[model samples]
Target chain A: MIQRRHALTVRVTHWINAVALILLLMSGLQIFNAHPSLYWGPSSYTGAGPIFELAGGFPSWLTIPGTQWLAMGRRWHFFFAWILVINGLAYLIFSIATHHVTRDLAPTRSDWRSIGRSIADHLRLRHPQGEAATRYNVLQKLSYIAVIFVLLPLMVLTGWSMSPRLDSVWPGWVDIFGGRQSARTLHFVIAWLLVLFFFIHVFEVIVTGFWNNLRSMITGRYRIEHEQR
Target chain B: MASGGVLLSACDAASRNPHVTKVLSIGEFLSQHVQHAVTSRTALAQEFTEADLSPEFRSNGTDYPDSAEYRALAMNGFVDWRLRVDGLVERPVELSLDQLRAMRSRTQITRHDCVEGWSAIGKWTGTPLSEVLALVHPLADARYVMFYSADPMDDWGTRYYESIDMEDAYHPQTILAYALNDATLPIPNGAPLRLRLERQLGYKMAKYLMHIELVDSFARIHGGKGGYWEDEGYEWYAGI
Candidate 1:
């Protein structure tokens, strides 16, 4: 039996986010390469220098222009940032309006109880099959919820916190994250966390039937191996 | 891109896609309009105390302008230097360094955020630009104030320049800084005068000042883009 996995909206938004995030990351690196350093506290120069100062910033191929071009890099970063925000907002609205959150995303009491079993199964590369395979597992729900809800929004806020004009409109708001530099640090850290999630996500996709997962995302069809319940 | 060389041939041959850039510019357009609309008229950039000042104020791009005109003025301690205020103004004024110093001043300690994502805080003391505007009353048609700097950005003698709208022109924190860290503004830091556009990125702060031209539009200016960097494809609005 072929399970209808992802909704059309989910598939569309997921691809949009994929492209937007990749461009954002690349262009972000190009911007980072300008100063090639990260700091803590309210400012970069505390007489202590930066904690995460890179002599030569992120290399080419990782950066959008594949060379240092802060001006062009900024253009690309801000452009895709709007794409990310718009797509994410659309996804959020759909999730809420359709009760997709409660139906699929929110972890259940049973999922909480099955944590140990889920961990064991994951460690052994033994994924659920047949009827169970149709739904998201406990770990999948948790990671997706965390990334979509917590990390993405925080990154956006931190990004805004760095803007001087925004800081003027609401002074001391950035102080919540320690300061602009500290907010900047948090932003960079969150970006890496997202990258880590991406790698793990791709790895999981490969392990749990690559083509099955890929097809499910692209065509919303995942063929469950066994016909019997 | 300030000093970052475009090293790859791909940057020119492949990545200089006009359609891609045009599409990207819509992002710039939206950001400028949205941010400008939302920003309050009374909103002021954050100011800090003496304790927040950087131990050593660092500068990028043309610390000490090596131009013959700038060098001559510096040699005479800027006594001969004059800040030309002309263009769309009723009274074209050429105020000397001493005259500018005699004017009412406002000093503030603020962060200088570079487009490259680094920031440094410094104390700046200078004549508020509103005071200058009063002296040379801008014409009703004037929309932008062009700042001509002493530092030449290119071998072809294209000097550094910047411009701002009248809203910023009168912002209290927006000043023509002649001093940094309570000392005479260092040569590398724009010397006789520099713009302190507190709400924008550092590039918007033109240094080593020479003239102030109030214009209805900057279309007739070099490259007709308003600023030296703007011509090079950077956004005219650097508030973000």
Candidate 2:
């Protein structure tokens, strides 16, 4: 059976987000390489030193320049940051106006009841087939919701928190995360969490049906092999 | 910088291309405009209490001046040094360290944020840049206040320089800091005098006092950017 799984808006934004995220992560690590350390609270050189330290930072292959250039790193990061923000904003507004959030993403009462079975199914490497395959599972819906609503917005806010210019918008907004350095720490953590989500997302795609899922994201078309009765 | 690339070695040169840099500048331009539009000009950077002070502020970039003129002034405790205030100003006055120290001072414990993503909080006490501007009487043509430093950033003796627009130059927290942590400024931390631009990153705060020039534009200056780092590829507005 064939079905339309993703909207055109969704397909377009998915690719943009993928490209923007990859560039943002690479360039972000490049910037982090300059300092090679993370700290908590307000300041870094408090004599107590960094809470977590990486002597040489992440390897160059993982960085955008494939080398250490703080200035270039910043250039790549700030450039793509705008792209991601704009794309994400468009996706959010489109989703709200179309009620895509309620229709496709929000979990229903039945979905909540299926939570335990979904976990068992996932552990067994079993995926819903036929008509169910056309719709998101409860787990899928929850994960996407968390990433879109909770994590992504927090990442952007934490980023703004670290900016001295943005801090002028409200004198001590960064204190919500403890301080500027604390905000930095949270931003790093959220980046890794997003990375983790990427790996899991790809893994699920491969295990379930890579070609079908990939094509859906690319062309908004999903083909389902109907299960025999 | 010597480490080997584990992946994407093919694209290394792509990042260094000028065309790529030109493309990337769109965000920088947008960021500056967005920040100025969103935030009030008089808004202050967050300040901290004495308890939040860092034990020791790490000094990056140039620690000491290698120039003979800077060393001579340093050797004599900067008594002979005079801060020249000129350019787009009517008075064009010069003030000594003692004179600056005597000005009505403003003290605040503020964080120094570096472009490299490190921060240090310390108490800064100094003559506000506004006080100097008031004495000199900036002309209507003045748009930016350019700061010249003692340290030579290159082999050609192009002294480190930085500039701020009128809004930042007149900010209450923008001061020509002469002291840190209630003591005389140390050699490593821009001795005699330095700038404290609390709303921006560390590089904007030029150190090792020499001259303050109020100008209509910095386009004719070195590399046609506002500061040393700006000439070397860093963003001119580093409030980020």
Model 1, residue A103: C-alpha shift (Å): 1.8
Worst 10 residues of 2 chain A by lDDT: A41-50
Q: Find the candidate with the highest TM-score and give its number.
A: 2
What is the C-alpha lDDT profile of model 2 across A5-117, one tens digit per residue? Answer: 99999999989998889888999999889888999988887777788889999987789887788888888899999999999999999999999999999999999999999
Q: What is candidate 1's CA lDDT for residue B172?
A: 85
TM-score of every model versus the real structure: 0.95, 0.97
Q: Looking at candidate 1, what is the lDDT of residue A67?
A: 69
Compute the lDDT of residue A38 as modeled in candidate 2. Answer: 91
Cα RMSD, each candidate = 3.5, 2.2
lDDT of model 1, residue A43: 83
Query: Each model's DockQ?
Result: 0.56, 0.70
